[model samples]
Structure formats: structure tokens, C-alpha cells
Target chain A: MSRESVINWIVLAGLVAVPLWAHLSDEPFTITLATRAVILALAAVGLNIALGIGGLVSLGHAAFFGIGGYTMGILAHHAQTYTPVMEWPLLIEGTKSMPVIWGLSILFSALAAFLIGLLSLRTSGVYFIMITLAFGQMFYYFAISWAEYGGEDGLSIYVRNGFPGVNTLVPIQFYGLCLVALLIVLGFNAALARAPFGLALGAARQVPARVRAVGLDPYRLQLLAFTLSGAITGLAGALFADLNRFVSPTMFSWQLSGELIVFIIIGGVARLFGPVIGAVLFVVLEHWLGGLSDYWHIYLGLMLLGIVLFGRGGVIGMVAGRERSHD
Target chain B: MDLILLAEQILNGLQFGIMLFLMAAGLTLIFGVMGLINLAHGSLYMIGAFCAAAVAGWTGSFTLGLIAALAGAAAAGALIELVVIRRLYDKDHLDQVLATFALILIASEGTRWVFGSFPLFLDIPEALSGPVMLPGGIQYPLYRLALIGAGLGVAAGLFLLIARTRIGIQIRAGENDREMIAALGVDIDRLYTFVFALGAALAGLAGALVGAIQSVQVGMGEPVLILAFVVIVIGGIGSIKGALVGALLVGLTDTLGKIALPGLFGLFLDPAQATQVGSALASMAIYVLMAMVLIWRPTGLYGVRA
Candidate 1:
């Protein structure tokens, strides 16, 4: 096997081995942490489709994320009450099944992504970033105002939405579900990167004018990637809601968007498994530093500054340098 | 709505717009001259508010507090410009964004550590505390009126400085060609530091001035900062004239939309349902305006195309 292949295998093995050991030992906290890592990695992978392949610096992925969470929350609320969402105009009801929630999450996020991406993708550079941020805030304020859906206080799920025979309330089962979703998403991301469309997106990122000159509209490709990215992130948001059994406007906050970017950057932008490393390290640092004191963010800020200044490749890049150099 | 209420809202809008202009002015100047996007511009605003609150609390004088805020923000700006921002001039927008974002974290957390999470309250001076009657029999807060005056004064002063001053001439020249200006022995580093400090001072003044109306606290600058970004974008990035027009337009649009949209919707729909839909639409109104403007004129009203 090649060096990269060996490294990939070892990394994958370590991922399974660590979680498996935690599961065997009945360490709920560790299992929970691992589960969160997987879900967050999935979300970051969604972002990579736009940021890495499409060269779109979206500072508003949290909108889709919150949409996913709200999908679960709104649906679960109706499901628990056993009421149709809209009895007057249309008979739209909530679902108890996870599959239904996931479907809705993807569809909702895809639709939102299309609308936002249409306006945002009109501009490039800093303009795009600012517009996306504005749109995210718009959704955040909307959620905050819509008191029927819990508003600023947020909504709570009475139980884990059903997923066939699996009792999702169990940490191990939920973690397993998250891990599976994460793996599938990762596989999709890697395959997409090597796919013809992915190649075109990458080319557009490198040289948009050149791509345009060659008779391709970069905008359509970016919009498609952006939509796919939103759908995947929406999946993660659904899982996150289930993980916490709560949904709030805070999920859509710019701070959350910033954190997602931090995850991708700390892991190594555009690298497969970059967000994975970033999410794991970020959570681990938060957990560790949070245990030490209430003022952990100060130290976190300093550490981030150090990383940006000195360590450009993030932690994974440090461990695995320039894997299979292309040039 | 009554004419008094309308007039009051307009005054409020102008005050808010002026504050945005103060923030956007510096941002536009920096971007125009340096081609850098500093996300931590908000941090400077926060610093100013904190400085004002702290000074006022210590000395019990609002004027002194305002001065301290300006000086502190300008100093912090100069420090950041020299130590961090100077290196970012030649880098891509992404690098500038990330680095400045890191600065925000540090500044925010650092402020939180120094000052607890609870917001610091700054009192308006007793002299300016009461409402003054305007020409239309509308009662307005004297402090808010003062802010509007200060903003206009700054605007006029800035226009003069940029239009006629020797340094302003150099700045305009520098914006056009940095290398050529530098070759003429214009101490580019000092010019950059001065410009950065000037921007910081403007943000600080806005923060301190607005602190009277709002709470002085960490993260307070973020909302205003975003508004300022909207203003600059709408005005055309790197255009001072654009920033002024954009700020006023945004301030009026946002404030008026919040009041007008709900009322307009209520005229037809039931009050409760109207409120629900109108508020949502109002929140989205500015963005819709932004999108319309972008579609109509991508470069902005006064901004020259990049």
C-alpha cells in the first residue's frame, strides 16, 4: 500500500478503535463526544463542497444548519402533540420517523441554499461573504421572533425521534448512526472531489475566468455545489438536534458559522478529513479547557491566534504533511 | 402614525445612520488605501465603548469619557495596524479575514476577562439627558441630536480633509498607486498607521456616542459593525461618499421599515397576523433592498467599479 493509503487506514482504524473501546467500556461521555465529532465533521464536509471545490467562502452555512435543526424541532413538536402542522391552508403534519426528518432536512436545506446562493453567488470576494452573513442573521432574527416555534427560548424534544428498531436515546446507537452518516458523507465528499464536476469546480476555483473562457458557467456549478453542501450540513443539523434534543435560534447565529469556518481552517481547508480533525480537536480543546476554568475562551483565542500565525495546516496538517504532493 | 412619531423616527434613523457612517468611513478608507478587509474593526468599536464607560465611571465626567474612548481606540488601532495589519496588506482577502477574525476572538475574550459578562451602563450627561423639542413639535433626546451634529461635522471635516488637505492629497494618490507614492518618499508605513488610527478613532467615537443610548458591553459592536458593512457595501466599498449615502439610506430604511411595514400590513390583515408577517418581512427588507441594488448596480451608487 502507498504511504497515504497506510495513513488513511490507520486513521480510519483509530477512529473505529477509539469509539469501539469507549462503547465497550460503557463510557457514555466519551461516546457522546465521539458522536458529536462525527456529526460536526459531517457538517464541515458539507461546507467543504462549497469552500474547497467551488471556492465559495460562505459565512452563512449555519442558516442551513439551523433549518435542519428546526425541521426536526418543528416536526417533533407536532409529532408529540399529534397535530398537523397546518390544518387551515394545507394538511402538513410532522413525522416521528428519522428517515422522514432526514428527507425533510435535505429538502428544506436544498431549497434554502438555492434561494440564498442565488442572491449571494451574484457577487464574489468579500461581498459574497457579507451577504451570506446578512441572510443568516435574517433567519436568526426570524427564528427569534416566531414565538410559536419557541422563539429565543427554543424547543425541546420529548424523546429521540424513532429510527426503525434502534432506540436513538441510547448513546451507543445514536453514535453509531452518526458515525455511519459521517462515513457516507465523507465517502461522498472524496468521490465528488475526483468526479468530473468536482474537477470543473476545482478548476473554476483556481481560474474562474479561464473556466468561463472555456465555455462553462461557473455560477451554475457553484450553485449546485452550494446546494449539495447545504443538504449535507442540514443532515448534521438534524443529528445535532437529536443529540441535544433541543432547537434554538442560537444554532443559526453568526458565531456558529464562524466556529464552522474555524473547524475547516484548523483542520486544513480543502483536505479530505480536514473538518474531521478540526471538529475532533476543537471539541477536545473545548472539553479540556472548559474543565479547567470558565474563562477558557480566552485561552482558546490565543491558541487560535498561534495556529493562524504559525501552523497553517492545522493539527492534521502537522501530523500528515503535504500528503502525496501534486506538483 | 402621527407626524411627531414619524419625525422622531427620522431623527432616530439619522442618528443611527451617522453612527454607521463613522464606522464605515474608516473601513472604506482603509480598504481603499490598503486593500485590506479588517473584520476586527468591530473590536475597535467595542474598545471605544469600554474605554468611555470605564473613564466616565472613574472620573464621573462624560466629556472626559468620550475623549478617553477616542484616544484608546486610536491607540489600539495603531497598535494593531503596526503589529498585525501591516503584514496583511499584500495577502489575499481570505488571509486578512481569518487573521482579523482571530483578533476579534482575542479582543472579545480579553474584554470579557477584564470586564465581566454583564453589560456596563454609561449615563448620558445631565445636561443632555432631557428631550428637546424640534421644529415639528417632536420631542428628541438631546444626546441623540448631539450625535447627529457630531456625525455631520465629522462628515464635513472629512470631506474638507480629503478634498483639500496635503495629507489627503497624498492619501488619494496612495490609493491610486502605492508603489509610485512610496517612491516619492512619503513614509508609507506612517501614512498607513495614521489612516488606521483615524479609522479607529471614528469607530471609537461612534461607539462612545451611542453608548449613551445603548448598553456598553462586549460584543455590542458586532451588530453595528454588520450594519456598517452593509452601509459600505451599499455605498460601494472604498468610497467615502458612497459610505455616507449608504449609511443614511440603510439607517432610514431599517428604522422606517421596522415601523412602516408592520403598519402597512396591518391596514389590510388582522393586527396579530399582520404583525407576524410584517415583522418577518421588515427584518428581511434591508436585504431585499441590498439585493435589488446589487442587481441594478453591482458596484454601488457612488463606488467606482473595481
Candidate 2:
């Protein structure tokens, strides 16, 4: 077997081992934290597809994430109140099952991403980055002003949304759900990256002229990749909401989007396992540093600066040595 | 809306656009001359406000405070260029962006470390504090009018500096072709440093000027920075003329949209709902304008195609 496959297997084994240890030892807190890491990693992985592979440099992935969270939050709220999400005419109503919520969340995030990508993708480079940020800010302000839900205060889900035969509220069970979803998304990402479409997407990143000379519309390919990236990220957002049992406009902030990029960078972009490693390291650092002082962000900022300036290859690159030649 | 309210809002937009112009002019120049995107430009604005507030507090003179702020920010800009930013000119936009982003974090935290969390208050000087009567039975704040006057004066000064001076010729040459000028015996590094400092000073002046109207806090430059980015993007990356027109357009659209959209919507909808919708639309108006501009003129209004 190739080195990457071996390493990938080892990592997968470790991921399975963690939850097993948590459940066997009845360490609920550890299980909860691991679950949180997985959810965040899923979000980062979604961002990786856009930023790392497609070179989109989106600074507004948070909009898709928040849309995902709100889909879950809105559905759960309706379910709790014994009300239908939409009672049109006399018979239509939305369901609050886990599968249903996931589907809706993915759909909503993808749709929003499509609309935003349509406008934002028209511009390239710095203009693209700024436009995405502006749209994110636009949605953020909209959420803040639309007080019908939680407004600035945020909305809480009292009970974890139900899944058949599984008490998803149990930390271990939820972690299992997250792990399954994470694996599926990561597999999709890997497949997509190697697929013909992903090749076109990657080609667009390096030279649009070459890609265009090959008879493919770079814009359409990029939009598709962008939309898919949004959908996966939205799925992560739904899981994140379930994990926290809450959704807030803070989820949609540009700061969060920047952090997601930071995660990919720190772990090593374009690698399937990069976001996972980065998220774990980041949460651990934040937790440890947060305990040390109130000014942890200052230290975190400095650390990130040092990493960006001196360590472009990041942790994974350090371990893996110099990069492989894709060309 | 009443005609007076309409006039006031337009003025507000003009004032905002002018403030944005100050920030964008320096930014566009740095980008045009150097091809570097400095996110820490906002930090310079923040520093200007802090320096102004602190100096005003110590010297008890707003004019002195403004002078100190300009000098201090320019000095800080020069220092940063000499020490850190000079290195990044050869780096990619991502590297520049990340490094500058780090500077923002450092500058913001460092400022807070010195100034504490509470906002520093800079009062409007007595000479510019009161209301001034305008021609159409309208009264506007003397300070805001002064800001408009100051902005126009600076614009004129910038025009003169670029048009009628040796430094202007050098700068224009540098912008057109950095290497040719360097080969022709200009001290390119020093010239760049000076331009950066000049831009920083303008940003600082803007900060101190606006600090009286708003809170002078560590993170105060961020919102304005983003708006300035929008202004420059709409104006075109490396064009001062574009920055000027773009800033005013954004300013007027933003300010006037907030006032007019609500009133316009009120004709068909409930006033309260219209206010909510209008305010949201107003906030988004500048961005929409930017998008439309990009759609029609990809290079911006006055941006040379390159």
C-alpha cells in the first residue's frame, strides 16, 4: 500500500479508537469534546474544498454555515411548538427527523451558496474576497435585524433533534453520528478532488487560460465546486447546531470564516486530514490558552502570524516533508 | 422625508464618503505604487485616533492633538515599512494579507494594552463645535462642515502635490514603472517609505477627525476599513481619482439610501416595517452599488484598464 493510504488508515483507526475509549471509560466530557472537534473539523473540511482545492479564497463561508444552523434551529423550534414549518393550504408540513433536517440544511446552504457564488464569483482575486465578505456581512446584519427568531440573544434547542433508535443526546452516540458524517464528507471530498470535475476546478485555480483552452467553462465549474463546498459546510453547520443545541448570528461572522481558513492553513491545506488535525489543535490551544488568560486572542493572533510568516507548509507538511509534484 | 432631513442625510453621506476617501487615497496609492495590500491600514487609523485623544488629553488643544496624531501615525507607518512591511513587498498577496492581518491583531492588542478597554474621548474644539447656518435655512454642525472643508482642501493639496511638484513627478513615474525609475537614480525604497508614511498620516488625520463624533476605541478602524475597501474596489484598485469618485458615491448611496429608502418604502408599507427594511437595504446599498459598478465597468470609473 502507498504511504498515504497507510497513514489514512492509521488516522481512521485513531478516530474510531477515541470514541470507543470515551464510551468504554464513561468519560462523557471527553466524548463531548471529541464530538465538538469532529463537528468543527467537518466544517473546516468543507472550507478546504473551496479554499484549498478550488483556490476561491472565500471569506464568507460562515453565511452557508449559519444558513445550515438556522435550518435546523427553525425546524426544531416548529417541532417543539407542535407546529408545522409551513402549513400551506391545508396539508403541507415539514418534518423534524434527523435525515429530514440534514437534507434541508444541505439544500438551504447549497441554495444560498449558489446565489452568493453567482454574484461573488463574477469578480476575481481581492475583489472576490471583498465581495464575499460584504455579502456575509449583509446576511449577518439581516439576521441581527430579523428579531422574529432569537435576534442578537440567540436561539436554543431544548431537546436534541431525534434520530430513529438512537438517543443522539448521548455524547457517544452524537459523536458516532458526527464521525459517520465526517467520513462520508471526507470521502466525497477525496473523490471530488480526484474526479474530472475536481481536475477542472484545480486547473482553474492555476491558469484560467489553459483551462479555458481545453473547452471547459471555468466559471461554471467554479460555481459548481463553490456550491458543493457550501453544501458540505452546511451539513457541518447543522451538526454543530445540534452539538451546541443553539444557533446564533455569530456563526455567520467573517471572523468565523477567517478562523476556518486558519484551520486549513494550520493543519495543511488540500490534505484530507488537514482540517481534522487543525481543528483539534486549534480547540486545544484555545482551551488551554483561554484558561491561561483573558488576552489569549492576542497570543493566538501572534502565534498565527508566526505560523503564516515562517511556517507556510504547516503541521502536516512538517510531518510529510516537501510537497509532491501534482504536475 | 422633509427637504431639510433629506439635505442633512446627504451631508452625512458626503461626510462619510470624505472620511472614506482619506482612508482609501492612501490605501490605493500604496497598492498602486507597491502592489501590496496592507490590512494594517486600519490599525494606522486607530492609532491616529488614539494619538489624537491622548494628545488632546495631555495638551488640552485639539489642533495640537490633530498634529501629533498625524505625525505619530506617519512615524508609525514609516517604522512599520522600514522594519516589517519592506520585507513583504516581494511576497505574494496572501503573505502580505496574512502578515498585515497579524499586524492588525498586534496593533489592536498593543493599543488596548496601552489605552485600556474604555474608549478615549476627544472633544470637538470650541471653534468647530457649534452649528453653522447654511444657505437654505439649514443648520449643520460646524465641525462636520469643517471636516468637509478639510477633506476638499486635502483633495486639492493632493492634486497639487501630484500635479505641480517634483515629488509628484517621481511618484507618478514610480507608479508607472518602479524599476525604470529605480534605474534612473531615484531612491526607490525611501520613496516607498515616504509614500506609505504619507498615506498613514492621511488615515490618521481621518481617524482623529472622526474620533470626536464616534468612540475612539481599539477596534474602531475595522468597520471603516471594510467600507474603505468597498470604496477602493468600486473606485478601482490603484486609482486616486477612482477612490475619490467611489468614496463619494458609496457615501451618498449609503447615507441617502438610509434616509430615502425608508421614506420611499413608507409610501406603500407600514412606517415601522419600512424603517427596518429600509435600514437593512441602506446598509447594503453601497455593496449593491459596488456590484453594479463591477458589472458595468470591471476596472472601475477612472481606473486605467491595467
Candidate 3:
């Protein structure tokens, strides 16, 4: 295998192996930490499709993330209470099935992305960033005002949602599910990077006029990428909410969005496995530094400065080497 | 609504607009002249509030507190400009955004470490402690009226400085063609630094003025920062005139919508339900307005579309 691919495999193995060992050793806390890292990586991977491939710096991605969380929250809340979602619409009932929640999460977030992208993608550069951030704020305030389903306080799932063959209440089993999900996402991300759609989006990012000259609809291509990106992120959000058994408005905050972007940056933008590395580093730092001081963000801020000012290629670039670029 | 209530609300809107203008003025100036998008501009506002609160609490004089706020924030802005911003001038907006975001984390955490999580207090000056009657028989806070006057005065003074003075001429000239003015022996660096400090001072003044009414706390600047961003974007990013108009429009729309939406919804729904839904929609009113504006004029009202 090539050096970069070798590094990628090593990273993946370490992620899986560490959690499995932790579970085997009865270190459930470590398993939870690994689980959190995996879920955040999944979210960042979704972001990479739009940000890395399409060059869309969506500052409001937390909107979809919160959508995913709320999807799980609303559904599981009803299921726990033995309530139907609604009497109309053929009496749709709540479900604690993980697969069902994941599907709805993807569907709702995709729809939201399509709508937001429609208006927001009309503008580019700073306008796009601000518009997305504004959209996120709009959703955040809406969630806070949503009186039912634990508005400002957030909703809690009494029981962890069930996976078809696994006892997901066990931390390791839940971690395993998340791991499998993340592997699938990573595989999808890698394949998509080589796919025609991804290549076309990359082209559009660099030269929109040239894309149009080739008789391609770059707008539609980007919009589709954004929707898929939202779907994946939404799925991650569902898993995250599940892990905590809680969903709150903070999931939709701009800080969350910024942190997601930070993952992409730290991992190496436009590089496969970049967000993975970034998320791992972040979760680790959050764990370690959080224990050290309440003002740990000071250290994080300094680290971020060093990375932005001096550390190019992020952790991925540092370990895997600079990605060979053609465009 | 009664005329008195309406007038009071309008006055409230004006006060809010002026505060936004103070924030946006500095932001727009920095963008217009330096072509940098500084996300940490909000941190400077926070610094000002904290400084004002600390000084006022220590000395029991709001005027001294206000002075401290201006100097502290301006010094912070200058230091940041020299240490971080100049390097970013030739870089892309992404780099600038990320770097400034890092600064925000630093500023916020540093403040937290010093002051703790609890909010600090800044009392309204004793001279302007009570409500004053307006011409329309509307009672309004005297401090808010003073804020409006200060904002207007700043606006007028800024216009004169930019329009009538020699430095203003140089600033305008530099804006149009930096190299041309620099080649003529003008110190561009000093001018940039000066302009940045001026912007910081304006933001600090706003923070100190508003800190009396609201709790002076960490993270308080972010909401105002976002609103100021909305103002600049609506007014066009680089135009002071645009910032002013956009600020007023946003201030009015946001303030009025909060009052009007719930009432309008009550006509159709029960009072409690109306309130929940109306407030939700009200919170989103300005975003909707922004969307409408973007659709109509993508570059904002006065911003030239690229």
C-alpha cells in the first residue's frame, strides 16, 4: 500500500482497536470518549463533501446537525411516552429503532439542506458564509421557542435506541455501531472523491465559468453534494444525541458549526481522513484539557493559531504528507 | 398600540440602531480600508464592556469607566492589528476568518480567567438615572437618549473627518489607490493602524454605553456582533452610509417585529399559543428581511456587486 493509504489504515485501526480494548478492559469511560470522537468525525466527514470537495464554506452546518439530533429526540421522546407523532398522516408513531431514526434524520436534514442551499447558494464568498450562519441562528431560536418536546431544556431519551442485532445500551456495542457507520461514511467519502460528481464539484469550486463552459450544471451538482453532506451530518447528529441520550439547542449553536469547521481545518481540508484526524485530536484535547482547566480554550486558541499560522497540512498533512494536487 | 407606546418603541428602536451603528461603523471601516473580515471584532466590544465595568466599579464614576473602555479596547485592537492582522492583509478571507476566530477564543478565555463566569456590573451615571418625558408624552430612559445623541455625534464627526480633513483625504486616496498614496511618502502603515484604533474606540464606546443597561458579561458581544454583521451586509459591507441605513432598518424591523408579530398572531389564535408562535416568527423576522434584500439586491443596498 502507498504511504498515505498506510497511514489512513493505521489511523482507522487505532481508532477501532483502542475502543475495543477499552471495552474489553472494562474501561467504559474510554469507550464513551472513542464513541464521541467517532460521531464527531462522522459529522466532519459529511462536511468535507461540501467544504472540501465543493469549496462551500457553510458556516451554518450545525443546523442540519441539530435537525438530526432533534429527529432522534422527538421520535424517541414519543416512543418512551407511548405517544404517536400525530393522529393524522396515517397515525405516524414514534420509533426507537436506530435504523428508522437514522433514515428520518437523513431525510429531514436533506430536505432542510436543499431549501437552505437554494437561497444561500445564490450568493458566494462572505455572503454565503453569513447567510448560512443566519439560517443556523434562525433554527436555533426556533428550537428554543419550540414549547413542546423540551424546548430550551432539551429532550432526553430514557433508553438508548435499539440496533437490530446488538444490545446498544452497552457502551462498546454502541461504539461498534458508530464505528461501522463511520467506516461506511469514510468509504463513501473516499469513493466520492474519485467519483465524477465529486470531481465535477471540485472543478466548479475552482472555476465555475469553466464548468459552465463544459455544459455542466455546477449549481445542481453543488446542491446535490450539499444535500448528501447534510444527510450524512444529520445521521451523525442522531448518533450523537443517542450517545448522550439528550438533545439541546446548543447542538445548533454557531460555536458547534465553528468547531466542525475547526475539525476540517485541523485534519487538513480537501484531504480524505482529514476530519477524522482533526476530530480525534479535538476529542482528545477536549478530554485532557477540560480536566486541567475550565479555561482550556485558551490553550486550544493558541494551538489553533499555531496550526493556522505555521502548521500546514494539519495532522493528516503532517503524518500522511502533502496530498498530490492536479487542479 | 397607543401613540405613547408606539413612540417609545420607536425610540427604543433608534437606540438599538445607534448601538448597532457603533459596532458596524468600526467593522465596515476595517473592511473598507483593510479588506479584512475580522470575526474577533466582537472580542474588542467585550473587552470594552469589561474594562468599563471594572473601572466604574472601582472608582464609582461612569465617565472614567467609559474612558477606560475606549482606551483598553483601542489598545487591544492596535496590538492585535500589529501582531496578527497585518500578516493577514495579503491572505484570503478564510485565513483571516480562522485567525480572528482563534483570537476570539483567546480573548474570551482570557477574560473568563480574569473575571470568572459571573457578569460584572456598570451602573448608569447618576446624572442620567431617570426616565425623561418626550415631546409626544412618551417616557424614555435618559441614558438611551444620550446614547442616541452620542451615536449621532460620532456619525457627524466621522463624516467630517472623512470628508473635510487632510487625513480624511489621505484615507480616501489610500482607499482608492494605496500604492499611489504610499509612493507619495505617506506612511500607510500608521494610517491603517490609526484607522483600526479609531474603529476599536467606536466599538468600545458602544459597549461601555450599553453595558449599563445590560449585564456586562462574556459572550455578550456575539449577539451584537452578529446583528452588526447583518447591518453591514444589508447596508453593503464596505459602506458607512450603508451600515447606518442597514442598522436602522434592522433595529426597527427586529424591535417592531417582536411587538407586532405576537399581537398579529393573537387575532387568529388563542393568546398563549399566539405568543409562542409569534415570538418564534418574530425572532426570524430580520433574517427574512435579509433574505428579501439579498434576492432584490445581492450586494446590499449600497454595496457594489462583484
Candidate 4:
């Protein structure tokens, strides 16, 4: 195996081992933290597809993230309250099933992403970033004003949604589910990175004119990548809401979008396991530094500033030595 | 609808647009001159507000407060440019974004550390506190009118400085060709610092002016910052005239939409649903305006092709 592959294995193993150890040692909080890392890793992995591979620096992924969270929250809410989500021409009922929520979250976010991508893909660079941010703010303000579900206050699920034959209420069980989801997405990401489509997308990112010279539409390729990226992030958002048993408009905030980008940067942009490493490190830092003081963000800021200024390559890049060939 | 009420809303929109122009002008200038996207610009706005509030509270003089705001934000902007932003001018947009984002965290928490969690209040001066009758018999706040006048005055001054002054010539030259200007014996580094400080001073002035109407608080700059981004984008980045027109358009659209949309919707939908839907759409009006503008002219109405 390659050096990076070996490190990836070590990181994955550590991810699984820590929560197992936490469960055995009766540290439920540790398991929860690990779960948080895994879900965040999953979300960042989603972003990596666009940012890392397609080079689309989207600042609106929070719109999808919030869509996913609201999907779960709204569905489970109606289920608990015994109300149908829609009772019009075609009756639609709420579901407490995790699989159903995930499917709907992925579907809704993918649609939103497709539409957002269609318009946003027309522009590149800073315009793209600002447009995406504008779209995110659109969703954010919509959420805050759309009081049918919950306005600025947010909605909550009374109980964890059920998965087939698993007690998701248990912290360790939920952690396993999230870890498996993350690993599956990571594997898909790995496969896609080597696939023909991923190659074209990467080419489009590096040299769009050349990609176009070859008779392929760079815009279409990017739109597909953006859609898939949004779908994955949407799934992670559902899982995150389930973890917390709550969803809020804060999910749609631009700050969350910025944090998602931070994860990709800190992990090593474009690395398969970069987001995984970054997310875990972030959670650990938050926990550790948060214990030290209330103004931990100042220290966090300094660290981020230091990294951006001095360390071009993230942790994975620092260890694995400069992403040999973008393969 | 009363014509007088409509006029009042229009004036309010103009005031808001003027404030946004201050922020957007600074942003466009920096982007044009430095080729850097500084997210920390908002932090400088917050600094101005905080400084104004603190100084005003201590000395009981709003004029002193506004001056302190300008000085404070300009100093902070210069320090940041020297220490951090200078390094980022050559980096990619992504690096610039990340570094400035970090500065935001540092600035925000640092502000909180110094000022505590609660908001500080800044009061309008006695002279500009009350309302004045306008040409149409409509009453408007004197302070807001002053803000409009002041903003327009600054805009005029900026135009003069850019068009008529030696520094303005250098700035315009620097925008066109940095190396050419530097080769002509200009101190490029100092010019950059001065431009950045000028932008920061504008933003600080805006923050102090706005703080009189709203509570001076942490995280307040972000919303306005995003709006300013929209303005610049719609105005076409790197174009001062575009920034001005775009800011005014956004400000008017946002203000009028909030009041007009609900009433318009009330014509079709139930009052309750109209209010809800109208408010939601109103909130998104400027973004919709941006999208439409982009659709029509990808480079913006006045923007040069990128």
C-alpha cells in the first residue's frame, strides 16, 4: 500500500477504535464526540467532491445541509404528532424510518443542488462563491420566516428514528451507522476519483478550455459533481439531526458553510481521507480548548491563520508528502 | 397606500442604499487595487462601531465618537494589512478567503474578550435626533437625512479624489498596471496600505453612523458584509460606479419589497398567509434581483468582462 493509504487505514482504524474503547470504558460522551466527527467527516467528504475534485468553491452547501436536517426534523415531527405531511391530491405521510428520511433528504438536497448548480455554474471564481452564499442566505432567511415548522426557534424530534433491527437510540449503535455511512461515501469517493467522469471533472477544473476542446461540456460535468456532492452532504445532515434530536435554522447559517470549507482545507484539500482527519482534529480541538476557556475561537483563529500562512499542505499532505499526482 | 408613506419608505431605502455604498465602495476599491478578497473588512466595521460607542459613552460627544471610529478602524486596517493581508495579495482567492476568515474569528472573539458579551449602545447627536418636514410634507428623521447627505458627500469626494488628485491618478494607474506604476518610481507598498486604510475608514464611518440607530453588537457586521458582497457582485466587482448603482438598487428593493410584497400578496392570498409568504419573498428579493441581473448581464450592467 502507498504511504497515504497506510495512513488512511490507521486513521480509519483509530476512528472505529476510539468509540469502541469509549463504549467499553463507559464514556458515552466520547462516543458522542466520535459520532459528531464521523458525521462532519461525511459532510466534508461531500464537499470534497466539488471543491477538491471539480474545483467548485461553493459557499452554499449549508442550504443542502439545512434541507437535510429539516427533512428529518419535519418528517419525524409529523410522525410523532400523527399528522400527514401532505394530505392533498396525493396523500403523503410522515415516517420515523431512518432509511426513508435519508432517501428523502438525498432527493430534496440533490434537486436543490441541481437547480443551484444550474445557475451558479454559469459563473466561476468569486462570483460563484458569492452566488452560492446568496443562495444559502436565501434558505436561511426562508427558514427563519417559515414558521409553520419552527421559525428561528427550530424543531425537535422526541425520539431517535428507527433503523432496521438497530436501536439507534444507543450512542454506539448510531456511531457505527454514521461510521459505516462515512466509509461507504469515502469508498465511493475513492472509486469516483479514479473513474472516467471524475477524470473529466478534474480536467475541467484545471483547464476548462482544454476539456471543452475535447468536445465535452465542462458545465454539465460540474453540475453533476455538484449534485452528487450536495446529496452526500444532505445525507450527513439527516444523520446529524438524528444525532442531536434537533434541527435549527443555524444549520443554514453561512458560518456553518465556512466551517465546512475549513474542514476541507484543514484536512488537505482533495485527499480522500483529508476531511476525516480534519473533522476528528476539529472535534478534539473544540473539546480540549473549549475546556480551557470561553473565548477558544480566538486561539482557533490563530491556529487557522498560522496554518493558512505557513502550512500549504494539510495534515495528510504534511505526512504523505504533497499528493503525488492528484490520483 | 398613502403616497406620503411610500415616499417615506423610498427615502428609508435611499438611506440604506447609501450606507451599503460606503461598504461596497471600500470592497470594490480593495479588490480592484489589491486583487485580494478581504472577508475581515466586516471586522473593521465592527471595530469602528465599538470604538464609536466606547468613545461616545466616555466623553458624551458623538462627533468625538465618530472620529475615534474612523481612526480606530483605519489603524486596525493598516495593522492587519501590514501583518497579514500583505502576505495574501499574491496568494490565490482561496487562501485569501481562509486567512481573512481566520481574522474574523480572531477579531470577533477578541472584541468579545475586550468588550464583554453584551451590546454597547451609541446615541445620535442632539442636532440630528428629530424628524424634519420634507418637500412633500413627509416627515423623516434628521439623523437619517444627514446620513444620506454625508454618504452622497463622501461619494462626491471619492469621485474628486479619484479623478482630480495625484494620489487618485496613482491609484487608477496601480489598478491598471501595478508593475508599471511601481517602475515609474511610485511606492507601491505604501499606496496599497493607504488604499486599504481609506476603505476601512469608509466602512468604519458607516458602522459608527449606523450604530446610532441600531445596537452596537458583535456579529453585526456579517449580515451587512454579505449584503455588500451582493452589491459589489451586482455592481460588477472593481467598478466604483457599479458599486454605487448596485447598492442603491439592492437597498431599495429590499426595503420596498418588505412593505410592498405583503400588500401585493394580500390582494390574492389570505391576510395571514400573505404576510408569511410576502415576508419570506421580501427577504429574498435582493438575491432574486442579483440573480436576474446576472442572468441578463453576467458581468453586471457596468462591469468590464472578466
Best of the candidates, DockQ: 4
* Candidates sorted by TM-score, best first: 4, 3, 1, 2
The collision pairs in model 4 are: none
Per-residue CA lDDT of model 3 for A171-280, tens digit only, reads 99999999999999988988888888888999999999999999998889989999999999999999999999999999998888888889989988888888998999
Model 2's alpha-carbon lDDT is 0.85
Best by lDDT: 4
> Can you give the TM-score per candidate against the true fold?
0.97, 0.94, 0.97, 0.99
TM-scores of the candidates, chain A only: 0.96, 0.95, 0.98, 0.99
Instruction: Estimate the TM-score for candidate 2.
Output: 0.94
The weakest ten consecutive residues by lDDT in model 4 chain A span A318-327
Tens-digit lDDT track for model 4 on B151-201?
A: 999999998999999999999999999999999999999999999999999
As a whole number from 0 to 100, the lDDT of residue A35 in candidate 2 is: 83
Q: For model 4, what is the alpha-carbon lDDT of residue B41?
A: 85
Docking class of 3: medium
The residue pairs found clashing in candidate 1 are none
Native contacts retained by model 3, as a fraction? Answer: 0.52
C-alpha DockQ of every model: 0.60, 0.48, 0.68, 0.78
What's the ranking of the predictions by lDDT, best on top?
Answer: 4, 3, 1, 2
Off by over 4 Å in 1: A1-7, A323-327
Whole-structure CA lDDT of model 3: 0.89
